[model samples]
Target: MRTRRTRAATAGIGAAALAAAASGAVLPATSAAEPARQQPPPGCETDCEKVFDLSLPYDVRFTGWRDDSAPGGRSVLAYYIGDELHDSRELPDRGVQDAECGWDGDAQRCAVTYYTGAHSTGALSALLTADRGIEETDSVRGGAPGATLRQLDGNGRPDVALRQSTYDPNYADAPRYWETYLEFEGKFVRTGCGAPEQQPSPAPTEPLYGSCAYY
Candidate 1:
């Protein structure tokens, strides 16, 4: 993950200029204009903080907050275009535990992870583009640790690989590890290509085709 630094500009005149003005000294006039200050969206006026920001290629920002006043402390993910709110989505969990954003080929992608309770976790993945705007591409409710991008098939584009776990009462001593692969065909769709139990390793070494059972 790359971290970009944002420089905040001071809005007022310099201390030396203020002192010179107070001393009744003539000062040279300047026509330079101050850079526009970025402001948070109206929805974030109360309690919100920007968790992620990307300035390259496009100006994208993610603002998140947990509404303590609301029941169960509802979580929100707000999308921004240079501080101006483009849209916002309500998260299924309480708050965002982690967030990641970067370019996936020509599209900009983001994944947000959150905990539902003490024992369970969930994730939300979003895709941003010029024509489609920002769209929620995928979501996992429980037992999702994280997501990664990979080339699982012959397609040149990258696919989304989600790591998940499930518990079976019959196999109480062992938890089953499962993976969900999503391919972008106009939009994101399940490929049904990953089965951790069937493979000798956690992930398949070769490209997967069709269904895991058949392949």
Candidate 2:
């Protein structure tokens, strides 16, 4: 079970709406004419480097999306506090159709996502912390912003998805281990696949107070 909520006003926006955007459903603000941005693919490669600073600490809070339709709905935000290579929370899932991973040296954390959304209204935020200390760092890929990775499940269906970025400590001519930025874009995964391989029958974890973490 998750713990209590923590409220932070780093960004002024509703959480529910952010989650919706994370799901890839377009909002009123963006126009269809706007050229769609290319997304990243699953796994790590040297070619990803988009970064944005939410200017907030790592914590969970219930900003919006708290209605019965999406119970346990809240905006998740976190600062990567683990080592390189892998995020402890970024577990593999059979249901995950696609996945993308990134590491931020500035934040000193790793971020892995199953999907993405626009403007962070209803986006699900997962922290990239390791059970062990931090992981080792490796070569980086020059990345672009707003790139997404789409995943297809076992039944040839879309399951997990996410946005990602590669770390470049020297991005702004900063020193190694001193430079940090977020790269990549958001993702939209199928509804059924939670964190674990199997999920509850009724689908949509929120209604059942579900989370990505499954026993």
Per-model TM against the reference: 0.51, 0.17
User: lDDT for each of the candidates?
Assistant: 0.48, 0.23
lDDT tens string, model 2, 1-215? 12221223234233443554455543211111211332222221222222222222222110111111222221222122111112211212211111223222212222222222221111222322223222323212112122132223322111222212222333332211111122222223323222322111222312111242211
Name the regions of candidate 2 deviating beyond 4 angstroms. 1-42, 53-83, 88-121, 132-215
Q: What are the candidates' C-alpha RMSDs?
A: 14.8, 20.6
**Candidate 2 TM-score, C-alpha based:** 0.17
Which consecutive 10 residues in model 1 have the weakest lDDT in total? 26-35
Model 1 Cα lDDT, one tens digit per residue, 1-215? 11122333223323443554456543221122222555544445566655444342334455555555545555666554554556566654356655655445455566565666544555567765544445776665544444444556544334444544444343333343445454453344555554435222454433444443421
